[model samples]
Target: MRMNAKDEAEMEYFGSTIRLQNENVTLRDTVQALNAALSARDDELANIEDELSDRENEVTRCERALELRVAQFNQEAEELVQQKEDHRRLKLECKKLQNQNKIE
Candidate 1:
């Protein structure tokens, strides 16, 4: 048996309503997934920032140690130069005394 125009119209309306409800559910699920992804990314960013800070602190420590080593080397170099000068003066004095003794 063929349906009347009224029954056909009601059936079309019901089908359209079901489609709209399905589309609404799909949109809600998509929004929830995007939010979760964004939260995870934010957590990763925070961890990276912490690592960067730690590296910066390590670099500062290394720089200070290098400066201290440089200072120590400079002091050692100065002492060596002074010792050489003293040795040369002593040798010259010994040579003068030997020459005088030989003339006498």
Candidate 2:
């Protein structure tokens, strides 16, 4: 039996409502997936920041060690120069004693 226009119009309205509900569900799921991907990206950025901080700390430590080494080298160089001057004075005194002994 063929239905009248009124019945067909009601069925078409329900069909349109179901399609709208499905569209809303698909949009909600897409939004959730985007949020998850954004969270993962944020975590990766944090890890990179942590790695950079570690590297900066290590560089600071290395610079301090290099400064200590340079200071030690300077101290040793100064001691060597003092020793050389002492040897020069001793050599002059020995020569004067030899001339005095020859005169006597």
Candidate 3:
């Protein structure tokens, strides 16, 4: 069976229409896949940002704690110095009294 010129033309037009439709479907699927990938990456970025923020907060807490400890150590060192000075003066006074008693 031979296809007349008009029938051949109609068949070609339908074939072209089907090809165009398939291409459109493929393009739509590609766009959907890209959108899903972008959404996933956005979620991952948000999670990473949250983790970074948590670490920053922890560092701040540690710094504050260290500062308090350093202040406490400084106060203790000052007290120790004052106590030593007092002890030295007491010893000098005791020695002087002992010498005067011996002379008497």
Candidate 4:
């Protein structure tokens, strides 16, 4: 089958057009896939940020609780020290009275 020059030119042009269309379709699909991947990554980043914020809040709450506990412990320690001093004073007074009676 011999193709005339005009027919040959037309066939070449048709083949070139088909190749260009295929390339365009491939490029479109690639761009769509990349966009989808980028969107998923952005969502993941947002979720991580939310989780980080929550954890930071929890840490702050724990620090406040610990501070309260420390304050309570200090107050209780001060009370115990005052009680011990009172006990010591009473014991000394009782001994002094007993010695005075013996001297009389």
Q: What is the C-alpha lDDT of each candidate?
A: 0.95, 0.93, 0.98, 0.97
lDDT of 3 by residue, 11-94 (tens): 999999999999999999999999999999999999999999999999999999999999999999999999999999989999
Per-candidate TM equals: 0.74, 0.73, 0.82, 0.78
TM-score, cand. 3 vs. native: 0.82
TM-score, candidate number 2: 0.73
In lDDT terms, which candidate is top?
A: 3
Better of 1 and 4 by TM-score: 4
lDDT of 4 by residue, 43-66 (tens): 999999999999999999999999
Candidate 1: misplaced stretches above 4 Å?
Answer: 1-3, 97-104
Number of the top TM-score candidate: 3
- Residue 25's lDDT within candidate 3 is 100
Q: What range of 10 consecutive residues in model 1 has the weakest lDDT sum?
A: 81-90
The best-first sequence of candidates by lDDT reads 3, 4, 1, 2
Higher-TM-score candidate of 2 and 4: 4
Q: Please give the lDDT score for candidate 2.
A: 0.93
RMSD of candidate 1 to true structure, Å? 2.5
Clashing pairs in 4: none
